[model samples]
Target: MTDTTSVFENSPEAEFGDYVALLKPRVMSLVVFTALTGLLVAPVSVHPLVGFAAILFIALGGGASGALNMWWDADIDRIMRRTRNRPIPAGKVSEGEALGFGLALSGISVVMLGLAANWFAGAFLAFTIFFYVVVYTMWLKRSTPQNIVIGGAAGAFPPMIGWAVATGGISVESVLMFMLIFMWTPPHFWALALFMKSDYAEADVPMLTVTHGRKATRTHILVYTLLLAPFALALAATSIGGPVYLAASLVLNAMFIAGALRIRRRDEAAAEADGYRVEKRFFGFSLSYLFLHFVALLAEAGLAQFGWGGW
Candidate 1:
């Protein structure tokens, strides 16, 4: 079947699962995990129900962003092999339906967050959705190689919003958490770009690899990985930091740096010979790198609850 045939299939009506897929549940999981870590690691304690409600609303806000992003990027999604199976591109859901679903959830989440927690957190959620949908998806994704760099802020805001839910304001610790994700994003995405360069090129997305070439992208990956290590280490020095986080940071950053260096050392011929194995491996490792760092933070929080965790 032709690509158009696949995309325009007169398939059965979209099932509930198709709508769930539009929310990008995998990405939402990361948002939920990081946001939960933010809430749990805060210095102040919230009532259990209030804390649960805050996280739920924050998660809905995250889901809404994903839906809107998919809706906006549907054209490019249809072009890119990896994204071709998404609800919109697969003809499982219409773009208009996705847009409406996203906006409804966005309003519900923000307003409920305000009533359930505080307007500060609510406003932050609103802005997170806006940044992801309007700023990154609509503008930067098509405009520049630095799209990931500037757009990374939207993904990094979840922890800050979660913190606001607990404390009603931002703090050094919250910003540190944001920085951790921000710095890690370039290397993480660049690694993927190294392998998925063709996808970005075909979609006219202007990813670093497509615009600046692979060697520069590799160099950039190493540079950002180096820069990310210090941020991770510095977070371990904050009020949120402790022995657990420090030890985890040291190990994870060391492994991450090694991966980046491996990718940086290889030429395109070598990468082709190995089927971009090193780049793909590093891309896989990058996911675990961010996840483990926050897991360590969560462990620190657990220890602090028993009075064992502190600087």
Candidate 2:
């Protein structure tokens, strides 16, 4: 369905690093971390080796999705400044090679995850790959401005998959973790879209800024941030939450809300004058914010073994 025909180039064979680049390492890191957190926080216990294998395969599944995304979006990647240097877009990797690589990894990750962990986790990984490539990439991505809004589910699934790996099931706690990521995705991405200039435009991607303009994007960011705060706090009420998580969420949410209000009140004139520092800082803080929440959750789980997680 993607118009990738004209985007081909004749170049040297791709290097090993090129294959790795195809995996979208940055995105994979988030998947690995969140997935690890999910496995760690689950009430059930898993052997260290089994848990490691599960996370590794889940990371591979995430990487496979990224590789296929690069393959499909090669045309647009060539146009977007941020993505122009990616292996597929740069001619370092052929589209067919990337496609084959993605498919192989997809099969291996899912089948092995099923064997190494549980069928549900493995099946979830398969559905995740399908949703990302078939639903988000081929369908929602170019078709709607709400693409990331729905597509966020692809990333949110890692934590749920991790939980499934541990417990072989889903629960309110795991769903809360999924919701935490789901609610955070929009504002997190919209911030990047805000200061990213015209990369989306040149690629013909209907990013919020490309569709609704910066004003609406800013407002949406604030609204999502406001909503995300309470959802995150709600996790503190679950079995996993503790005094530490509660304290961290309270302070973090206050700071996050303040940051969102600052961005909401910002105007184009002030943004240009300041190089969009506020938005950029908000973006950076968002990354830290997410990492710390998981870290707090992990801390609670760790301490809970000593009976300190709950109030």
- List model 2 lDDT by residue over 122-145, tens digit each: 999999999999999999999899
Models 1 onward score TM values of 0.95, 0.96
**Clash-forming residue pairs, model 2:** none
Task: Return the clash pairs for model 1, or none.
Answer: none
In order, what lDDT does every prediction score? 0.92, 0.93
Worst lDDT window (10 residues) for model 2?
Answer: 1-10
Cα misplacement distance, residue 297 of candidate 1 (Å): 0.8
Per-residue accuracy of model 1 over 169-227 as CA lDDT, tens digit each: 99999999999999999999999888887898999999999888999999999999999
TM-score of 2: 0.96
- Candidate 1 runs further than 4 Å off: 1-12
* Candidate 1, backbone clash total: 0
Instruction: Quote model 1's TM-score.
Output: 0.95
